[model samples]
Target: MGTFQIEGGHSLQGDIRPQGAKNEALQILCAVLLTPEEVVIENIPDIRDVNKLIGILGNLGVKVKKLAAGKYSFQSDDLDLDYLESELFKQEGSSLRGSIMIVGPLLARFGKGYIPRPGGDKIGRRRLDTHFEGFIKLGADFRYNREERFYGVEAPNGLRGTYMLLDQASVTGTANIVMAAVMAKGTTTIYNAACEPYLQQLCKMLNRMGANISGIGSNLLVIEGVESLGGCNHRVLPDMIEIGSWIGLAAMTRSSITIKDVSWDDLGLIPDTFRKLGIQLERRGDDIFIPSMESYEIQSDMDGSILTISDAPWPGFTPDLLSIVLVVCTQARGSVLIHQKMFESRLFFVDKLIDMGAKIILCDPHRATVIGHDFHSQLKATTMVSPDIRAGISLLIAALSAKGTSAIHNIEQIDRGYERIDERLRAIGAKIERID
Candidate 1:
């Protein structure tokens, strides 16, 4: 394991070009299994999750080639279904939640699929019932082994499209069913679908591959199944999560940083969410520029009441950024409630923030009330280990703005999402060093 020793109280000042979206890249990579032709993906982030997904593909007999830095070419002409039963496949496949998406394409093309229980940040009970419900609705027979903790599905007659409404707006569930529906026999109408930017990109890419899909940016998606899809080159969009992390880092360190290659149009409600905490960001052409301000104050309601920033489905504040928002709220001038509705355990990391001298109240498993410091008193640095990706970045931001040195262990978790995070922060004048 590696650790980041950061000398805090340094302002970050430089230009950062955001990498490709890890979420989008993983889905697109799995979509390669929908066809046997070569698909080239550009701007793929060199992160651990991406690499792990690529390994899964290769182990399943898909040909994945790294054509260039942040570029990959994948061809799944000879997919080996038996690989899914291997121990190596089971172990690595369950390591990330994104791995569950592979079940859709595998079932679509091969008429059957098996996946072990998917693992990710232990935030809450992330049930696969929605995904299984979608699969069964599409003509798949599902079964589970309690002892083995493995899920299996068989579509002997192939999948036929149907109209279905998801119980909730599950992002990965939406992506999984969408991929399955693209190759079904008839039409699939998905209501209450997740229409996040990553899903939009997936839909656009499927369209480019000859699948017919409508309602690209709305909750309702209509997909007309096709016999097969062709290969096409698609460029993943810039990482919005990284953009939010950088925004928090800049605000916490009182730094001026310009994040280039940001897709302002795809940033739905992110800027407004930051603005709620009085972090003003300006858009220059396509980039988001955060300037150094003397202090940031939380925006109150018209009745002079404290505002709550909460997460919902798409077009709402993203749950992934709530940790970063909590860290940013610590530097703001007033109090704000950071409600992480999607994940029950995500707010558990606020105790670490409290250890750093931030006033936080963990009201429940899903909510935290943060009282900002306004930089009136400096936060004391302390050694901590990263629990998950978002929490890791949040702790790093808090460390960067603290009064002394802090050591962050388990950096591998941070590297799973953010690409070359330490190097990137160093470029922006952050005094962070990596030690093995």
Candidate 2:
């Protein structure tokens, strides 16, 4: 296992370019399966999750060629659907939550799809009910095998579009259904759909491939099914998750950092959430400049009550960034309630924060009340093992802001999403080193 040894209390100052969105890249990669022609994808992040998904595509006989750095051409004309049942496929597919999206396209094109229980951050009960429900609405039959822990779906009559409302605005769930509906036989109306930038990109790509879709950036999406999809080139948007992490990192260490090429429009509710903690940010065109602040305070409600920041579906504060926000709030001057409504185990990471000398009360698995120390009483750094991608980054931010040296183990977890994080942070004046 590798670990990052970081000496804290250093202010990061530099212009760092954001990597491509990991979430968007994964869905777009899988969307390539809907066409047999070569689809060129650019600005893809070189991260563990994206690499693993590419491996999965290769196992399925998709011809994946890297033409240049951060650019890939995928042609699935010879893709073998039988590999979906292979042991290697099952093992790799179970490692990522995004793998569940393959089901929609595989079933739509090949008439059947098989996947083991998809694995991802153990934040909470990320249910597949919404996915299965969407498939069933599109005329697919699902069967779950408890003993093998695999889920299979088939649509004998092909997918026929139908009106459906998602139980919740699950990001992956919405992507899955959108992929399926694009090739259905009739008009598909999806209500309460996830309208995140990632989903918008997926819709735009599908539309470029001749799939008729309307309401690209709203909760209501209408798709007129196309018989087939053609290939097209797509460039991914900048990673907002990385932007949020960097914002938190700068705030915790009182650093002045500039994030370049960030999609300011796609960063819905993110800047506002950071503003709640009094982190001053200035937007110069597409770049975000986080100025070093002498003091940061949690903005309370109009009635003078402690502010509550929680996660909801799309266009709301993303649940993925809750861990980072929780860590950032620790260095703020006041108290804030962090409600991680979507995930049960996400807020449990606060114990590590508490150990770092921050005052935090874990109300339950879903909520925590954090009282900031404003870095007046610096946390003495120690060894910590990362748990998940978001939590891993959160711990890294905490370690960077703490005093003394901290050894962060399981850095691979962080690498699953963020690309060359140590290198990026080092360029920005952070004192961090990766050691095996």
What is the lDDT, from 0 to 100, of the residue 221 in candidate 2?
97
What pairs collide in candidate 2? none
lDDT of 1 by residue, 1-436 (tens): 9999999998778899999999899898889999999999999999999999988999999898888999889999998888999898879988977899999998998899899998987678889999999999999999998988899999989999999999998888999999999999999999999999999999999999999999999999999999999999999999999999998888998999999989999999998889888987999999999999879999988898888999989898889999999999887899998888888989888889899999999999988899999999788999998999999999999999999999999999899999998888888888999999
The worst-scoring run of ten residues by lDDT in candidate 1 lies at: 118-127
State, as a TM-score between 0 and 1, how close model 2 is to the true structure: 0.98
What is the C-alpha lDDT profile of model 2 across 343-392, one tens digit per residue?
Answer: 88987777887888989999988889999897788877988999889999
Cα RMSDs of all predictions? 0.8, 1.0
- TM-score for each predicted model, relative to the true structure: 0.99, 0.98
Runs off by more than 4 Å, candidate 1 = none
Query: Global lDDT of each model?
Result: 0.92, 0.91
